[model samples]
Target: MGKASLLTSERRNRSARGTQVRRERVRSAWLFLSPLLVGLLVVAGWPLLRTLWFSFTDANLTQLDQAQWIGVENYLYYQDGAFYGVLADPDWWNSVYNTLFFTVITVSLEVVVGVIVALILNANFKGRVWVRAAILIPWAIPTVVSAQMWLWMFNDQFGIINYLLMGVGIISEPLAWTASSSLSMWAVIIVDVWKATPFVALLVLAAMQMLPSDCYEAAKVDGIHPMRVFFRVTLPLITPALLVAIIFRVLDALRVFDLVYVLTSNSSSTMTMSVYARQQLVEFQDVGYGSAASTILFVVISLIAVVYLYLGRRQLGISS
Candidate 1:
């Protein structure tokens, strides 16, 4: 009886020590993370709060300092019989449609092509190292520079793209890649896919490289087909990495501004949410209206990210 009691006491003491150690570790972790938390609050949190504030006011570029609060007038109001503000604006809705379309198409294409490229790169082949290096060249180039280069290449009069298409009997005449409403969006998508596929491939390749080789060896010994092994074994293992790639790509595509702006230059057919906000803020000098649009964009992105992570986690059977 005495021995059992003593053992129980010792076990209790060890558990207490373990609890204390865990507490100390958590405290230390928070201490280390405080600086980064503070920096984010200063850099991102402050600007976001400021934008939210500006959204509720009648602030303009020239009179920003002397702005007046007007409630949610910039967002939506019904002073007249008809509705007004950003929510009711046709152009704003058009931009929203364009942004969503771009995000979906680009992300889907990038994932498919990136996975294929990653699979190819993962295979043992001659000049594998050089091929990997070359694949990343498009992603490494500056966005503005790449957009400008594509801009010139997309010229209908004298461009390599048109020349090739014409020479190959694809089109009888030189097609206007960027100028036409029908083809402008496709042009942007093509450029975006070309540039961003390497990023996704790199991510997926890293994930693939980390996978255990023993699985493949065992599958080979069992005489399992490569496709069957990949679907049943490899794809499931690499899904988490794919999720990460998809989320990152979605975020970038949703907030796409630079590439579209550079390629189309505020064209109605291809103008995204970011470009619409820019037009309001810079061109029209409607600070309050632009802030409202920017705030809506922030809310949309946050909701999408949250929902995506939730769905992804649920699919993976991971507990929050």
Candidate 2:
């Protein structure tokens, strides 16, 4: 063959090999991903799809087998030139408000207290090992167990919290911490912060340990205040891990059920979205409404995730 013909053949051969290599890589990726994809379908996707179907039907716990297609009757309605639905339900709105409030308070407290705890544990102090182990104790407790424990602590009579307050002359009467409308939500937030702050602290501590010491050393050389260094250097460096911790807490807080349910026993004041959904699904036997609530909860959580991810990326990209 001529020189040009030989060169063209070689180029085609190289292209063919490249295509084969890419095909093999794609096959390998699928080989590794197949198990996880199967697991997700079995564990999450199938149930979600079924729930979506139920949401659009007249499903109920009492007659689930005989459920009929009602077509969004549970989600929307029109009454004399007005629009109403779960979106218009005052109880649904209340639950949404309670859930968001609980999430915001607990996550904020956890992040702040977590940073302080992490900073303290990061220092070379006496009993640091024991303190670290103790910090994990609350987090290691089962959620139901922790909720029951807090319930006792917040009891109107014979509770440590009341005992302490009375001893300190803070209150003459033993207060009903979880029974009152105003205090019940705060009670839940406090319990959640107590239980979960350690996890955040430990995560942040791990991130802090991984941070380079050179930055701190340089900050010291410039005679910067410790507080200033934390904000200007440490926070920026730990943003990625902090974001992870925040996201973890946010997801958990948004779906909180056991703690509030166990502590307050479905009091409207502290009823969260998860609790409300369960009440409709299991107690009230309104499966259609319950599934709709669950679907809405999922959308709310997805929006939160997307917003945080977008903000984190935008902030990080700018800083970089």
Candidate 2 lDDT (Cα, 0 to 1): 0.92
Which run of 10 residues does model 1 get worst, by summed lDDT?
311-320
How much does each candidate deviate from the true structure in C-alpha RMSD?
5.5, 5.3
The TM-score of predicted model 2 comes to 0.89
- Runs of candidate 1 with Cα error greater than 4 angstroms are 1-35, 318-320
Model 1 has an lDDT value of: 0.95
In candidate 2, which residue pairs get closer than 3 Å at backbone N, Cα or C atoms, i.e. clash? none
lDDT of 2 by residue, 1-320 (tens): 69999788878788888799899999999999999999999999999998888888889898888888888777888889886667878999999999999999999999999999999998889999999999999999998999889889898997999999999999999889999899989999998999999999999999999999998899899999999999998888888889999999999999999998899887999999999999989998989889999999998999999999899889888988
lDDT of 1 by residue, 34-144 (tens): 999999999999989989999999999998988899999999999759898999999999999999999999999999999899999999999999999999899999888
Instruction: Evaluate model 1: give its TM-score.
Output: 0.89
TM of each candidate vs. truth = 0.89, 0.89
Residue 248 lDDT in candidate 1 = 100
